[model samples]
Target: MNASTTGLRRGLQTAAVGSAAAIALGFFSAGAANADTLVPLPDGSITETLVDGTVVTITRTGETANISPSMGSTPLHRNVWVSGSTKVEVSNGGSGTIQPGYIVACQLTLGGKSGTDGGMSTTWADPDGAAKQTAKTAGNLSIGPGQAVDYKILDLELADPFGAEQHRAANPYKGKGSVTWADSTLGVSGCAGYAQARSYVKVTVNTANVTGNVTLWGQPFSIG
Candidate 1:
């Protein structure tokens, strides 16, 4: 409850940052790692601390919120890195097209980096009956250790995904879209290595139509 103590607590409460060494060990809530030398946290979970000038890290059992868990087969969303930053800006990107009972597929760009990097992802089946899945990313992104990138993966207009009956060739359920992510968030401030930062993207499509559902399972893309 002292002024100095209150300020330190507030600072640490913010997303932990920077590199360093600590003058004194600090009190952290339980579940805190024993110390820089204690039993390591399980893999996936992350723990970092900055005290005085010391930087401490402890690993643990957990999932990187952004990276999807590995699936039996290719996951519905998987991250792939591109040459550019992963931070992207998407507009309503102009209204997407939807006809009475047909799906117009998004054009695919094929070949080299442009081809390999840009394209509509394969349409995946909705595992559950309800169309709950869609492409998207977690809020504010973690670009690297102690670093974060900010960007909005603009939502595009599309029809909701439907059931098995709607997956017909003639009544094609589709729309067009383009994705771009840049590491523009990183800079000379606390975020270092401006040129090396990156961002990850998850694309989801689910929209509703009068007669049928239309949707594309999410696919994760990474930009550097």
Candidate 2:
């Protein structure tokens, strides 16, 4: 080959190898850095009878979790988008309110497990085999290892009669109540361990005889 043509061929070959190497590095970096997980959760249901013979049935369906890399870009941060619907049915012509939310935990077993001793720190079970929890909020939350927090799925804002802003976290219904949520953001920070989340629906019913609370819990899913 001529000297000029030989030099051009070598230059083109070097450029091709360099481009291939850069593409391979980018592919591996994306696989390690931006890997996302999508989980389809099973439906949850529970039925119980209140003190006044009021039959309450709570169900959660069409549940899913899309877990992605944290915005913080560290092991201590996690982000998730959840979607589900909560339905409540009260028998005997009763009226009630429905509160739908999620419980996020790090290194803790969620539903069907007994928790600590007393006060709001305790986790108890109802007659229908559903675990109960306290400590609910509508804002950002932080928890350590072996800790969990509850948050409302809705933050409906409205003005009171005195021209003040008020946040309503629950909805009221007569006999039946239903609520659906999509693309709800649930984030966790300062957790150095694996994280999980579950859905819960709490219903407070008022009948002619008594007032009671019934809660139903969904299956737990990982968020890493």
Candidate 3:
């Protein structure tokens, strides 16, 4: 695949200053030629250096990584609206074991209007426009031992019924949610050993005029 496409897949696969001062000084006197020349021994010489003269070094190493995904549910003012999108970020929190070739599947629960509920539906979509009514999975790219994958879900379409009862019933939009995704499934192909397989899925919800708080949860997995 192309670079853009590859990056997109990699992103969806996982389920996913200060300053100091210093000074240096030199002591020298120009007197008569007969005057004895005083030499300063290098007993850790004192020098007047500029504040920026000092150097600081930082080193990074290893292949282990961590992925984090966050989802938000916002109250829509309109009768018909979409749930707040979810943003997933990946971090290389030091080196750790991760599945080598695999994808991540995420699932979300779209709570419907409670109380005198009426017609309310929700739908989920991935970055690639793939629809996910429930939890969807994606992945199968190579993530350097210390690398990470991140992406967002922007398609959570919600349709709600217009009425005070419909809104009051769903007063406290409390629902159980889950996100399940895995890297590409690994297997032998032809004479080659294990290789990567590409797959992608989106997570979304279907609800409207949500009057309560929404929470999202995810399960963790590592690639071999």
What TM-score goes with each of the models?
Answer: 0.18, 0.74, 0.16
What is the C-alpha lDDT profile of model 2 across 121-217, one tens digit per residue? 2332432222233344444557665566666888888999999998888898999989999978887887777877778888889999989988887
Q: Positional deviation of 2 in candidate 2, in angstroms?
A: 31
Query: Can you write out model 1's per-residue Cα lDDT over 75-185, one digit (the tens) per residue?
Result: 121222222211111122212222111111122223312221222123323222211222223322323212222233333444445532322111121333333332212
Backbone clash count for every predicted candidate, in the order shown: 31, 0, 45
Q: What stretches of model 2 exceed 4 Å from their correct place? A: 1-28, 31-33, 108-139
- TM-score attained by model 1: 0.18
What lDDT score is found at residue 174 in candidate 3? 16
lDDT of 1: 0.25
- In order, what lDDT does every prediction score? 0.25, 0.77, 0.21
Ordered list by TM-score, greatest first:
2, 1, 3
Report the lDDT of model 1 for residue 134: 25
Please identify model 1 stretches exceeding 4 Å from their true place.
1-147, 153-174, 180-185, 191-196, 207-224
Task: List, residue by residue over 98-183, the lDDT tens digit for candidate 3.
Answer: 11111222222134222112111122222222211122222122222111222222223345575323211011111222222222
Pairwise TM-score winner, candidates 1 and 3? 1
